[model samples]
Target: MSLLEKQPNTSSEFEVDSQRRHEQDAHLDSKLRTLRLLDGARAGATLLALLMGLAVLGTTGHALQAYNTSRFDASAGGAAWLSMWPDNGAFDVKPTVALVVGASLVVLSNVIALTSHHRFVRARLAAAHTPLTFSAPFVGLVVAIVAVILFYVANQSATADTLLSWSCRWRFLNTASPAPQFASLCRASHAGVDLAILLIPVEFAAFVLAGFELKLQRYTAAYTHARKTPSPVLA
Candidate 1:
């Protein structure tokens, strides 16, 4: 028989070949979708990380400058301690407002990322969605959560007594001092800086986790899509 001649068994062979090709095409499409989502997530995460890193530096610098240059004073009856900023202080600082701005930037960056994800899903998966598509909305919810958590964490470092909270505790714990001491009274240089430093890592971890969650959503969508697509039909 000629190469193109129809054989009795050729119909079955052709169906199998077509099915395999269909599966391969479906899988390739899934991978491409996944890669696009992953790219968006990575870019957003990078920007968020940069903003948070700047926040860390700003908090540390504010704390250190206040410590080094601001005048630490106490009430006559020793009721309270205060760090009074000098207009001429070596480190001019605005921890609360600055941190708020930083937090806003973080929130903005995450919002843009999440919006991108949503648009992709609505445009691509809305019609032929699987149970996995429910995850489309759920995909970047973690980023919003991270933004809120980071905002609060940043707030801690910006608060007035944040450093003093740990400073007094440290003096009471490690020093011979039996009484709780205000930052001015204790003169502990490290003070709340340690807590601020510790939170930096926690902030970093939150962003990292958010990125992973985005990836998880993308991979799951791809898998579900591949599984749902029908194989090629036999003639």
Candidate 2:
């Protein structure tokens, strides 16, 4: 073909290539937008998990304090003998503390993952540089499982004993009785346990989303790099 004829063909080919690249870039941008929305959802789940954990800790602590106060009252003589929570004695505070710690750790790990993701998306950090981010989901998952086990043990301990009966004492006991206060405390304590159980799904969801986010982030990074890099020219 003549040089002038060949020039037109080359120009047409270049135009086609440019248009294809533009379309690819647009597709990647759409994927990134979807990823941002997913990240937002993950953060929301993590926040909810944190709130529920705090509620468990507060209600359980207040209940234990009230139960202890009841032990000092003479009118509620039998209240001291009542088992309103785990462990045979008045109430075992250790398990509750352990569960709270585990749950807190789970929330912390999720937060770390979310932070890492944000940094990565902003190009301020690389996924490889943040090793903790990769492991955060696993850590959160394991801790959540441990917290759930502790909750199950606590639930079993309370259910197997007279805990439920004591918690409901306010309904059966006279309103003038000092034991009603003890019953309220017992009920609150168990409510904390219930809250923890109810939050298990949320905790799992946060970790799951984190894991998915991590994988998607790596893929997106690779795709972006591949698209941006100049391909090897054939001689």
Give candidate 2's whole-model lDDT: 0.65
Model 1 scores a C-alpha lDDT of 0.45
Task: Look at candidate 1 and tell me the lDDT of residue 96.
Answer: 31
lDDT digits (tens) for residues 90-194 of candidate 1:
222343334334444544544444454466765776553323322322333343345345534643653344333344444444322222343442343232233
Worst 10 residues of 1 by lDDT: 83-92
Clashing pairs in 1: 163-192
| Stretches of candidate 2 exceeding 4 Å from the true structure | 69-98, 107-138, 154-165, 169-171, 174-180
For all predicted structures, in order, the TM-scores are 0.35, 0.73
TM-score of 1: 0.35
Runs of candidate 1 with Cα error greater than 4 angstroms are: 1-6, 71-162, 166-235
Q: Write the per-residue lDDT of candidate 2 for residues 32-151, one digit (tens) a residue.
A: 987787678877876777677677767766665565565456335655544433454644455556555775676677667666657555476663424555466567667767766875
